[model samples]
Target: MVNTISHIHCQNCSMAPLCLPKNLSEGDMARLDTIIQRHKPLHKKDLLVTADAPLRYLYAVRSGSLKSYTLDDHGVEQIIDFHLPGDLVGFDALATGRHRSFTQALETTMLCEIPLNSLDDLSAEMPVLRRELMSMMSSELYTSKQLLGSLNNRAADARLAHFLLGLSQRFADRGLSGKSFRLSMTRADIGNYIGLSVETISRILSRLQHENVLLVENKLVEILAMDRLERLAG
Candidate 1:
């Protein structure tokens, strides 16, 4: 079920605050709206962008979630990142002009496609767009470093805790409930991202629930004790 809306304005987009046009002026936003093309809903496991494909547009996730991954020599998929609503994907191709990883929908997803060629002209006229793009790239780099550090951790519990805490903060940034949210990724996906086995991920979650630090019901998770979770993450 895809819903494509024509003539949508960034100034009125619910995700504007967390998107590229967060601080853009009204005039700039109108100009931006001209270049954005809203896509229909992508069903689960649909590829938004394929690895090695030529990059044409940057995608702003409007709703639902997506995952970026790459396959190893043995054909094992190495999950790299989870993109939530308000996250931008395809920036990795800015320098190379080709996507390095596959981006696939984790569930039903909607996005706004920003033509990359339009950005140069737009940025030249509106300096704020350039600065915002740079800021967003820097933030993405920082997140990559953080994920690298998390992957190096030997403790399974710590990695799991860190992952949950990270998601909580991200959800909070989107003006959503930080204490409770449904996880779009499955336990197997979580294990692959955090360098743990699926059984280990289940064990750690069970332990957290046993300690009353979290409450997990299927995919829905509620952090009952944020302070405890933070300590565990550390």
Candidate 2:
């Protein structure tokens, strides 16, 4: 069972800058808000959507995190990407009209739901919104490409460093502390996403901690040496 969160308009959302266009007029923003549906919080491991489901709405991560994944022919889960606040989901369904991967909550999460049909009609009247949506889709594509590049031909330790730094920057972009945060996903999920083994992930993390570059205790991580971590990532 799911429970709903309180209403918060787009104009008042702190993530508006990251999730919405900067130039939207008051009227446009209000119109967009009207089309949004707020959902109850999702608990840890709850499936938000499953593969091949019809695409009814796109989701904006209001808080917490989610992981998108699909199973391989051998029945292995292939983790695609982990989404954070300000990130959008459901783009994977746009081309086929059905979801291509399973999306689930990594922890308790809040999301803003935007109906696709209503958004289509609204975007037709609001060029700004249309453009912003297109920009977001394009940005998603670019991030996917960057992830592929990061995974290719990179050493295991370098890959881990790069992944951590990427998360750090993403958190900072959301006006949160970049140097410390919780790892919403498990080590195995990180390994699967970055093309490393679970053991490799733990070993790399331990090595980093030993080097005083980061302090890791359970899921909590603190960057003790940002400069050194950046150098390692490079």
Candidate 3:
């Protein structure tokens, strides 16, 4: 459930540099902030957007994480992406005006909801805003392509290693420790996203731990050898 919360101005948000507000003039930033709405934190498993839902707001994750997935004909979930803080959600709906996948919080999450109509109007007057939005969308597309390539060509162990390395870079980009972080998605979810079985996921994790490449304590993973992990990922 979403509850209206006090606003946090774009100028004051730490994510400003990494999110939509990046490189915007003060006045433009202020205008952009007007359309962004804050909400009470979402608990684990709370759906942010459902497939085929009308496009309303594009969400900017402020904290925690979320997963976007789609169901096949058999209703099996095909996990697409895991959204961390500083990531944008809902771009998938822009072309059709309906969401293509279901996005749900993997843990407690906070978001800034940008009303689509207002953003469309505001972007007309702000070239910087428009450019930033395009850049984000392009980045999203590139990441998707990279994921597809990895799934097609990488081995199971390489896929898992690459996934962990990707997480490390994302966390580090958000000013967190690159060597250690919590995994919000369960092993099953990870396996689904990377095209592996739950048992395979467990086996690879245990193998990494045994090889002294990582220290795994339930959801907590500490990369003990980043260089070795990179080689494994390659």
Give the top-scoring candidate (lDDT): 3
Q: Residue-wise lDDT of candidate 3 within 1-234, one digit each (tens)?
A: 432357467889888888999899898899898889896789999999999999999999988899999998999999999999889999999999999999999999999999999999999988888999999999999998988877887899999998999999999999999999999999999999999999999999999999999999999999999999999888
lDDT string, candidate 1, 1-234, tens digits: 333356455877788999999989888888888889888779999999999999999999988999999998898999988999888999888889999999999999889999999977889889999999999999999998998897684488989999999999999999999999999999999999989999999898998899999999999999999999999888
Model 1 residue pairs with clashes: none
For each candidate in turn, the TM-score is: 0.97, 0.95, 0.96
- Who is ahead in TM-score, 1 or 3? 1
lDDT of 3 at 17: 81
**Over the stretch 1-234, how does candidate 2's per-residue lDDT look in tens digits?**
333255577888888888954569888999999999887789999999999999999999988999999997898999998999888899999999999999999999989999999999999999999999999899889888988888888889989999999999999999999999999999999999999999998998999999899999999999999999899888
Least lDDT summed over 10 consecutive residues: which range in candidate 3? 1-10
Q: Which should have the higher TM-score, number 1 or number 2?
A: 1
For model 2, the superposed segments whose C-alpha errors exceed 4 Å read: 1-6
- Judging by TM-score against the true structure, name the best candidate: 1
lDDT of each: 0.91, 0.91, 0.92
Q: Which stretches of candidate 1 lie over 4 Å from their true place?
A: 1-4
